[model samples]
Target: MKKLLMFVCLSGFAGFPSTAVAAPVVVGLADGLAGNRFPWSTTGGMRWQQVFSAAELTGFVGQNLDQIAYQTVQGATGYTISSLVISVSTSNNAPGSLSSIFANNIGSDNTVVFNQANVTVGANSSSGGFDFALPFTTPFLYTGGDLLIDVLAGGSSSAATFFRANGSAVTTERVYSSQGSPGDAGGTATSNGTLVTQLNFTAAGAPELHPGGAVLPLTFAALSCLIFSRRRRISY
Candidate 1:
């Protein structure tokens, strides 16, 4: 009976530890370009078109996505960033028709992890850009893949929004134009060799356990229990 009790206890204690207090891991992509100017501000007609860029997230396969950070620039009149949307997909290419890449058009394959209409980034004092962080109300599990973040400014023509530019010879970033509505279809997305944007995010989870490590704890517990049982029998 004692051996059976020991076996039950060992089985229950062999599972992965809870990650209640694990520190969040920060992941980011920097815009290597030197300029502070906003790209794609003038390309998407006067309607609401957004630039699309993605960063490959490694080591964050099973973490929970917490927040996203982005940089933007404002015009003379200043701009308000009322909405921010983020989507995730395994594919590097934009999903759906080239003309539109809205949340719905991407189909069920994509997950919109963050959606908010009241996001605000105050006006800039100069042409230089500023950075802001948007926290997710409900975090989502990051199944280890690339993240695509879309910044929208309510389709206002008076104000200009900018994403940090990457000067790399080649990039995964693409630009597309939408009618400014979440449901509206967008124009074909294109990538210019000179322009790309930066992206960053935070995730929270315990470090993954290796196979050997997982087995070590259970083995130790079973051995200790066996020793205790043998000692008790000898004393009796």
Candidate 2:
């Protein structure tokens, strides 16, 4: 009877799934200077429509933009991750097109990479790149806040000028063809034109999803049965 019972238990172990076999999935959230809300959508292959200007983005650094708007993994267990990459793109236009990037710790009042990069637009065809590696001590975990990008300035001497916030400069230079006429500079070559840009957040590796309390309870019940059966044979 003891040998028979042992055989049954070992068979059950073979049937059960191993906890070590599951892989995790990761999710990330991104925010702009403006309060467009969390879980911002991505469309047009890689273009994001909800870009924020510099002034609209000032108070949000080092805080979770999720308090306003954020994104999440569809189904995943919260766990420590290896690293996260945040990307910022500046306009690739000629002049007045630049994107300045910044980051701050969530909850604490410190700059991660304050004004980290001032990108040129036309250098990358309406876009540039900014990536940050998670600091070893920080581990880069999101609370309902933190992680965001802002547009500090934008415009062109030959293009329309617009400020994301206060203290921005916009020049009215007509350089279509260097014509003396104000509106008819169509023949002049434009100068100092600035284009708008975007920011994004991505994570590396997989995240584990919580199986929920119900599944755990069922697993416990089965484990208990196995233990009880083994005890009965040993007692005899």
Candidate 3:
């Protein structure tokens, strides 16, 4: 019993069982060529939805989804979004299959992660990098499976944001509107294109503070161990 107690105490001290804070993690296609931009202000389009298969987003299972990041192409230096709403959800579909109907392709947990005005997106010096981001207002708890990204914006930029593409793997699908300020659900489905994008997530129930935050993990671990040792000594 005493040995077991010590083991348990030490485990806490050593940050066992994944209780430590989960660092912000990103998952997506590696850097690649320009794909396309959203609500291209130049054409007056308003909304878009990017779909990614469960195979691509499997890493997000059991995590709290927080941010959706975009990359800019080499041609344009900056992209400005006047009013934007970013939403995300999940689905259960094969990597190569997608329906032209937006409603036919999503789960019920669609969440508006970001809604802001007048946001400026910066450019990547090279082909494209995950530099533009919309920090979610509330982290979406991803239960696992396919992921969907819905974007609606009321702004414009001369340059475009590109995504990494895999012509061989049709794991991503997209839908967007060509008219200005289309309703959230109004958009024409386009040919399949795997977008190179980045998504960030936070682990749920993490007890440790961020690196510089007030309480350190070791502090609690040491205190717990000390208390346990003292109790054992008294019983003896």
Candidate 4:
């Protein structure tokens, strides 16, 4: 929310001071091709989520994350991600391997930022790269700790989204599935790699209120059993 101040001469009252929002701050890998084919629709659809640690989000302590964008190395128009839903949360999980239990990954205030039945994301013609930028309906406030982004979409898709990513971005972990639907239990937890995420925030940080409960899609229920593996841990 933008701040405004007004003064009235009739009452000889001077308006209180107001503060302007700061410029947006973006953090994450900018470009790389070693990523999954799509954050969009992949065969059998997909579910994707990545957590960013507090150290990486240093400057965004009080910021309101209003938008998130994904960069694709190869993409085109006409392709659509069906049953798309993008959600965010302050995760108890960190940059390392995500929990096999889904709820263990989510912290306080799970909120859905974007949801669309079907939509086409355009390519950035000038840059020769395509970007799928989704604005949050309810901008998430980054109070502190690790930030988690959960992306899910169902249905078969022909176009390959091929989002840019880096293996060297900080310790990373993601839960993903190729055999995903809009209403699946959960995906396999991978203890490596993360999408090069782009986060946009209100400079002054929106004065957001904290909610008591979470509004998440993949709530309680353990993920399909899989072999456990060693995970990299983000320092406390």
Clashes of each: 2, 40, 3, 3
Candidate 3: clashing pairs of residues: 35-162, 35-163, 164-196
* 30-70: candidate 2 lDDT, tens digit per residue: 22122211111111111111223333334323322211112
Candidate 1: Cα lDDT at 65: 61
Candidate 4: where is the Cα deviation over 4 Å?
A: 1-33, 124-130, 191-193, 203-236
Winner on lDDT between 3 and 4 is: 3
Top candidate (lDDT):
3
Off by over 4 Å in 3: 1-31, 39-42, 92-97, 126-128, 159-168, 179-181, 191-193, 207-211, 215-236
Better of 2 and 4 by TM-score: 4
Model 1 residue runs over 4 Å out of place are: 1-31, 34-55, 73-78, 82-85, 92-109, 123-130, 150-153, 156-158, 168-171, 178-184, 193-236
Full-model lDDT for every candidate: 0.45, 0.26, 0.63, 0.62
Q: Give the true-structure RMSD of model 4.
A: 19.4
Better of 1 and 2 by TM-score: 1
The CA lDDT at 198 in model 1 is: 28
TM-score versus the correct structure, for each prediction: 0.50, 0.22, 0.69, 0.69
Shift in Å, residue 28, candidate 4: 4.2
Indicate the residue-level lDDT of 12 in model 1: 62
- The best-first sequence of candidates by lDDT reads 3, 4, 1, 2
Q: For candidate 2, what is the lDDT?
A: 0.26
